[model samples]
Target chain A: MEESLYREIEEIIEKYREEETPLLCVLQEVQEKFHYLPRNVLGYIAKKMNVPSSTVYGVATFYSFFETNPVGEYVIRVCKSTPCHVQGAFNVLQALKRELGLKEGETSKDGKFTLEVTSCLGVCGVAPAMMINDVTYGNLNDERVREILALYRR
Target chain B: MAKTLKEMEKAKEKANLVTIYLDGKEAKVPEGITILEACRMEGFHVPTLCYMEGLSSWGGCRICVVEVEGQPNLVASCVTPVREGMKIRLSSRAVREARKTNLELLLSNHPLDCQLCDRNGSCELQELAYEFGVREIRFGGERKTYAVDMSSPSVKRDANRCILCGRCVRTCREVQSVCAIDFANRGFDTFISPSLGLPLGESVCINCGQCILACPTGALSEVSHVEMVWDAIEDPGKFVVLQTAPAVRVSIGEPFGLPAGTVTTGKMVAAFRRLGFDRVFDTNFTADLTIIEEGHEFIGRVKKGGKLPLITSCSPGWIKFMEHFYPELMENVSTCKSPQQMFGAIAKTYYAQKMGIDPKDMVVVSIMPCTAKKFECQRDEMCASGYQDVDFSLTTREAARMLKEKGIRLEEMPEENFDDPLGISTGAAAVFGATGGVMEAALRSVYEISTGKTLEKLDFYQVRGLDGVKEASLEINGMEVNVAVAHGLGNARRLLDQVKAGNSKYHFIEIMACPGGCIGGGGQPIPTNLEIRMKRIAAIYEVDKNLPLRKSHENPAIKKLYEEFLGEPNGEKAHHLLHTHYMPRERI
Candidate 1:
């Protein structure tokens, strides 16, 4: 399995070898091929490219675009920015706490949902918002939050 | 109004102070202060990566996470304000775990090239990663790749190591008011970039480097001349002459395990010698030359009606700022190159002529308390003698690192003097490193020259210390020399704007890029913030007060140099070797 994954990564690298934005393309390809970018695979890519692992790591870490850790089956992110806070995101957060029986920034015991608080979601017009996986839910209320969480539950 | 605890105390009944246990020590703190602030007030040194003084708190790093009684998750003390009857544990297992996890997350993205990193030993991120005992990053992924932006003369930006603390963004907008950089994108794609994707040098960056100081990692660092300097030092064929700027003596001590403001002049001289430099000179000597040239230039401008409000051209940061933000004000800046560059030009020509050494073989290295000096040395017109005047420039921190790498113990070394004529400087020149110092020093020299009478009090108390903007006037030779001093590009802009609006006019102006001048230069040392800058500024004044010759003209070595080599101040010989012209920057 490891050899196959390595070969796949190498093939992806070859496809993006002459691309102007090789790193970006390679990152996307790896993410698609292996659900999450693995540490060994990144190391292998870095070595194959003859680039410093740190430079590669720094690039991976600098942009919020890449995720090092794997998310649960469903990832839930709450907007705790100033505008959202002013619109009572704390109450929505409490509602999430009660519904999931889990605190902020924790994954549910059943591994159905993982919760987090992000900076601004740039949906200030809607005020409080949450993103389940990649889908964003805006103007969240207690009832709406429960209804949303219920859909993600196993 | 911000409604701080101290401010609220005067308006109403004093809010009861709460006692909190920090690392087993009990201390009373104001009720509304954060646990970090409370612990810091109590003198508990909790290592934090993302915390900064006088900025909106953003607990993005989670390095300052602390255990609070009744809280389920570890809280960022920086953002979490203190509450009455709140029990806090700073270094608890859970707190450590959270901090460790956060650091590991940060490290998973961090590049591991510490040796090549400019911030190497002094980086907060590197220090924390070491402290957290993160042997390996359990989770790693695709790294971000961006071209190195070396377009800026002063600062180099590496987005890879950036933790997105927004300190640089906040500092640029709030402190400096030069909104050159901002968060360009959202979510995972988010990164700080100049507006409209302009290169930093082309943007209205002002070259202050406050953002570099604000950045917690090697993501932002001064463009270094270490490799260039090391190469020169290694080549026995080259006569490497090193010059240390005045501000360096006070601030360089911090990196050497000495307290901030500890003046290590003798040790600095010793370190240069130990670094295998052929000669160790003082920028203060040329700083004295600057006064002679700049003072006469100011008087010449005033007498001839050339340009009123003749600004000091010593700060390269300010020079760059003028070129970018206030291109119209370029004519107001003095034609003289900075003291460090002046010394470099002279060392290659005048010093080489005196020593009977070939100018080609002479390698001039300037040790300054400035990152801007790095950009200054690489200027096209700086090479007056058919060779680059300064082969390389080292910051006070870099010099300290070189000393450490060479295994030289500065404190244990015997007191040494700077080599011959070039090394000499007066007290007035020494004070040029502090805020308002150049204004004060130039005033002392200009006042004496103009009036033909010695001033009783050498210190210009009005222009001294760490205020952002300082204004003063003195009647010299029956003419009111209206003067203003500004440190940090933010303050520089405010003062220059007033001048542009025709609100005020002055005979002389002093501006340093970093707050508190060279003593607080971006390249001085890690933790080069306001408090440390103030301490170094105080010590600079103290050094000035203690010296016998408080005026530039009183320096015997300078007088001798003029007598033996150069005929007079700003003379034909001096102009050829000491003075330099400025170039108008093409719009970025």
Candidate 2:
């Protein structure tokens, strides 16, 4: 929305100015900067890249890692895979949901944490694994989920 | 010498002959051709849903699958190329069952309201369902219930009936070079939408209606103004008049079982008169006026050091496209209003004045081979006559539909001449239906007017044909006038890109947004393919040759109009009513 913000996006696109498939790289960098892709940001990216906005929107919405909505400072992804479910992942999710006072896909009241479900973290060796932002929290229980969330609340 | 397609096909077949088996019979065919083409070549029938001619094929719909020996599953024939020693069966029991199942699946998601649907008779999906003998849809589930989008003035978007064939996506992107839509989201929730999921009206859509022509079902169609026209005709207090575009004459006969390129202009006027139109005029009359007006404008720019490369602005689609994409080149487009709008302006103002009628009481309707004309008529700047110039702008297809509703068969109607004053036109106006027609028409007048000589050859053969982009140099008054003609917005983009890069050398240009000009317009009759376009083009040229007056300046009525109402070409009086300006638009 700011002049500087548009200048910053132009810089990010300029990094891949010569790359053939620069759209994915530019979007990845943009998502890292804003924590999520804003609609206006995606539109700006499309204008800078000379690509259609539909393609940009498609790619942004396809990957689960890229969120189109505004997430809190910390995003909690609870694994809902078969291995995690067998290891009481539901109870771990319920503990986090109760602790944060938020349901799935809802951010906390204080903008501290957001909760959502993902397929798997590919760290299935630990069975019941959840991810907070980029860090994986494996072998989680109800008590451990509360204790882990308390640290972010501080 | 260039090789014809037939000669090239023969050479390809001879050079790379491959052994293949078709339904237990051995056959030799060309390699690298698609299995669908191979089957069609061998006279083995195969049904397809997503495969349209002149578009790229991806095996999205499995309805064209065939049984290939040694393969574990049936392969989609539309995307699979023929290989050496391949055995394929088109009508095997397994193949038929798969095709039938796929058809039922498409029907299961689609609403079964064919009787009340807009595309009831002309829908390809309906034809396929009938041909396959689909008794019922067994897989019943939650159908896609997306709301119909009536945001645009010209084309309507009904995603509820979409088959996800992606034909509209391909046509918008590949043919027109307007990437207004693409696949959004993914998998089951995938939808074709404009950039950033905006409504079609707010999006950078020129309303060319190519997507409606590309759609195989009821997913897309022209925003119908037929009811409005009908309501006006039924009102006893209102007087309704009609004008048909030149391109409509060649294609309006198609819906009534006439041939693709039959010139039925006289019968069209007769049908209009029978359908309750008080006066039936030709848009060709204003088309000749455009040649006179735009020709003088070109000469003015060339003489007075105005913007070189004056692009013709007769196509409303091309005008909007120039506004949104190439706004920096706004000065290059001529300020002349399109013939359809020009006819409307003069009809409601000049004609009403001459006939002692009120402009507010008279309704001017235009039947065009363009969907963009609908949007063009409703633009903010079109009401120069203190009222809406054109009351309704209907497509050629819509005009034929109205005739069918009134039981006025075009082929059965007797040939009749158009009314005097505004109905008279010349041969130069007839060529406006085809690509490069405006340039050809302009060159005829520009050459004669500049040199003060009668033209020997009326036809500019170099500017005529089905080529995407054409360039020619005409010597007028000993000055080499470099000119270019581009049809289809994609070709327009290439030529405009040259101008953007400061590499353009031409002094004048003609750009029409639809392929093959207005004959292949977005609002023309259905099944407008390359072959049909060439047929319509040849027929329009024939209409031009058969007419006695071949030049625009020689029209007696036009001279009379100038002497009585308008003083001269490009004069102040004519500028107030016939010329319009453009604005820069934001690309979504």
Candidate 3:
């Protein structure tokens, strides 16, 4: 049986019960456990924490780290900064797109990959880099990107 | 911090004095006061957009920025506390440039449809723009545009006009504790919306309209009923009648050049007549009726072992708040329809039958100092007369706009009287505009009715101030009737929580959603602050003081209403026409 969202939220709330302003930490843990934060889940969290639903929503949406929409098993972020753009990051992005058959901000039909364009991932030394499920791959080319995609696909 | 004026005054006496140099001149101010307050105290003007006096300062809008001699950057004077020997330039060249640039930047994204906006002359952003001489936007690029949300009957949200000062957000959180709206998205794409970006009507919004009042721009305003009212007036088949709330009479003069809280009931009636209403009545008439009916309900409840704490049900906003936040106490809330609704029901049923007119053709328009009254009037249960009891609930502001469009000046109109029967009311009815008024009005009649004695002094001074919550215990016929009055939803929550905890001692509670009752209502006036609320409260008391009839049950019209039309105060006919029910709602 699947674990109930309410029970999960309760455990998260209990973990931070002693902390003041535990909403952000609770929300972070909830998002970590689940790929995305559900609207009803947010409402339930708000009720449990005695915080206004709007305030919770504001905090959740303020930082881009928390995803409100459901994501696939792995989210691929292609860095599109000055250093990466100066390198062959654009071609690397196109190669990854072609390899995955997905557009930016689109999830694969198999629910295994979500492609996204993001700012620098703090790896300017290894330009033309991208991240996949918290794993960073720097100094990428079209061949390297396709190879990385194959590794994730399998 | 939004400290009360009384508290601020008391603090000033004991506050350590600090000397500050203003434009190279030495001035002394209370140490704990903010620079903005200190500046104003010294009779210097510091323009602000996001800073509201009775709300916590966000300091997000840099319009109130002033120069400190040592500080590298201009500080937001509203948030910066006054310090000793600090040099400040209120209107230096650099300060002016910064302010003007900020105003222009705000204008760059905002829609320039000032004349078409409901808050054209009253918009703080527009006022600042004009004052700063911002001729054109210097950085006009990438404007945020979104569809207007007319989802709520009480308020309209136009994202196109929002400057993101967060006054509405702060006011919703601080004043009402509703927190129904907040900034949902990040930079440029950010806009005020309910949780999960739901429309306001779908949220837990109580339709209080405090957000609309706190809004410094056209971003939030009442969903207008002016056009529908005009159409009703023009229709030959429709017999449109007008009813003005007690608060409307006191504050309607502010829109014109008259002073705040000027009694314009006569002139307002005259203007309604000019605007083509068949008859101009007073909600005060039903206010008197409400007291009678509510008093009877309270008496019967206390006597018959029904629900204790029979809360007065005059404020629609408070009703919605009860539905959302305190549904378990639904039985405690008085089932009596508000004066506005009661007037409509009577006008359509008894008055219509008496005048030999079809109820269908009778359009009841109410001029209320409430935006939630719009939602109340349109409730499916409001159609006790086989048609919607009230056709439209126009805000005082909206009614003033209509009068302006019709070229009817309230200041010039003669001191006429509201039409007969339904127009006549007692002094107790007039004070329904102020906080603690309904309780006082109810107490006056409750004491008199229960005791069967002519009370020498009618004034219930115990519950007649602008405190957030007021309590009084009265021995009516040896029955100790404990009562509490709470204005503003935040204050209402405090008492409701006590009831929810099963620790409430009061037998009756009067709750008004707005701060100063209807006088400081969301629909009252643009600048309905602490000063204006007090003035309106004083004016309402003045109206009560001078009236020949000081109590609700003493009104000749109300007595006649029961004698001729309604069988009794809470009789079968009266109950059917004058009562309604509430349902529990999903908070989010």
For model 3, residues B108-216, the per-residue Cα lDDT tens digits are: 8777889999899998888888889988778876877698898898999998889888988888888888889999877777889887778888998888898888889
- The lDDT leader among the candidates is 3
Candidate number with greatest TM-score: 3
Model 1 misplacement above 4 A: A1-154, B1-35, B43-47, B66-75, B81-94, B113-116, B130-136, B198-207, B568-588
Give TM per candidate: 0.74, 0.93, 0.95
Q: On residues B12-106, what C-alpha lDDT tens digit does candidate 1 reach at each position?
A: 34657877777767767767767777776666767787678756777877889988888898888888877766788888888888888888777
lDDT of 2 by residue, B234-301 (tens): 89887788888989999999999999889998898899999998898989999999999999999999
Ranking by DockQ: 3, 2, 1
CAPRI docking class of candidate 1: incorrect
lDDT of each: 0.79, 0.88, 0.89
Q: What is the TM-score of chain A alone in each candidate?
A: 0.75, 0.90, 0.82
The number of clashing residue pairs in model 2 is 0
Candidate 2's TM-score on the B chain? 0.97
Model 1 quality (TM-score): 0.74
Backbone clash total, candidate 1: 8
